[model samples]
Target: MKIRYKRMHLRWIFVFGLFWLILGVISITNDSENYFNYGYLIASLFYFGNYFFKSKNQYLTFEDDIITLNNLIPKKLNLVDLKQIKRSGKDYILRTENKELHIKTKFIDKNSLKDLKAILKNLQTN
Candidate 1:
């Protein structure tokens, strides 16, 4: 089976981008007095840009016996080599015979967590 996972809440990026755009417009309009700082607007735009690209890059794919996690930083782990899977606070920790990986689940839904747990159980059984 193929399982495709993507980060949720992409609209937040658009909303933040709009906020920055508005701030930039306001800053430009009131440039004569120079009371407002353009740095906040620039920083917000940068943050939105960063999030846009970073969120687009974050995903996890599971197919056959392989599990691939690609984020702003990419990592790949083989399911066949995994020795243990457990929950740690708000995260999921996957431990292999030689290495360990921790995935943050603060944004993962309850249903997704249940599905993931079931998958882990199946993996551990065999």
Candidate 2:
């Protein structure tokens, strides 16, 4: 199974990205130096990191015995070796002996989270 981030979060990310881009453009047009534009450009990096540059993709999937987190680079963990799952407010933290995965619930819809819980339960029983 594969799950995606919430559309609402993506919408906000797009809006923020456009705002920073506009700021960068305005700075370039109003100021003789483009140095002021650098701040806006740098600020836009946050949006880039979330939506584009840092991650080629962001999703979770299960196939056979491995679970994969497909983001930036793909990460796989053994389903049989799963350890702990912790919920903090709206975030989910999955920890194994030497590795920890942080999943932001705000970025995922309620239905996805519910499905994830059911998946975890199955992983636990097996």
Candidate 3:
């Protein structure tokens, strides 16, 4: 029916942005003559702005032979066209018969993968 996906982790971005911001502040305080200090501050601001505004939520759903993927960016795919499903390390690949579609699973747990496989199997049999 409906499956909800998770949001991207912002902790790393926050940490990196904070580190850069601190570095820039320290540089500005220590060397008032260098323009590079202002450059770092500008760069840090850009990173923070991008991190907060542009990130999207990721999710996958299978319903009535169609699989809908919403990774903030939206995609609609028909499960009937799906040719193969495979697991490669942490990612799951969904290949279509036309080779035009390649769906990758994100933030899916072991139970979710099992559930998806079961759904696919039913689709194949019918």
Tell me the tens digit of each residue's lDDT in model 1 across 25-75: 777787846745676577687778767765654445567777766565657
Backbone clash count for every predicted candidate, in the order shown:
0, 0, 0
Candidate 3 local lDDT, 1-126, one digit each (tens): 544333343556666778889999999999989988998788789778746643443256666887776544557777777777766765656678664444445545456666766776675677
What value does the lDDT take at residue 108 in candidate 3? 52
RMSD vs true structure, all candidates: 3.8, 3.0, 4.7
Task: Pick the lDDT winner.
Answer: 2
Summarize candidate 2's per-residue lDDT along 1-126 as a digit string, tens digits. 766677777777777988997888788888947576778877777786777632245467778977777766777877667788777887777778887777676666678778888887776676
Model 1 pairs in collision: none
- Lowest lDDT block of 10, candidate 2: 50-59
lDDT score, residue 30, model 1? 74
Q: Which candidate would rank higher by lDDT, 1 or 2?
A: 2
Q: What C-alpha lDDT do the candidate models reach, one value each?
A: 0.67, 0.73, 0.65
Which residue pairs in candidate 3 collide? none
TM-score of 3: 0.52
User: In model 1, where is the ten-residue run with the lowest total lDDT?
Assistant: 1-10
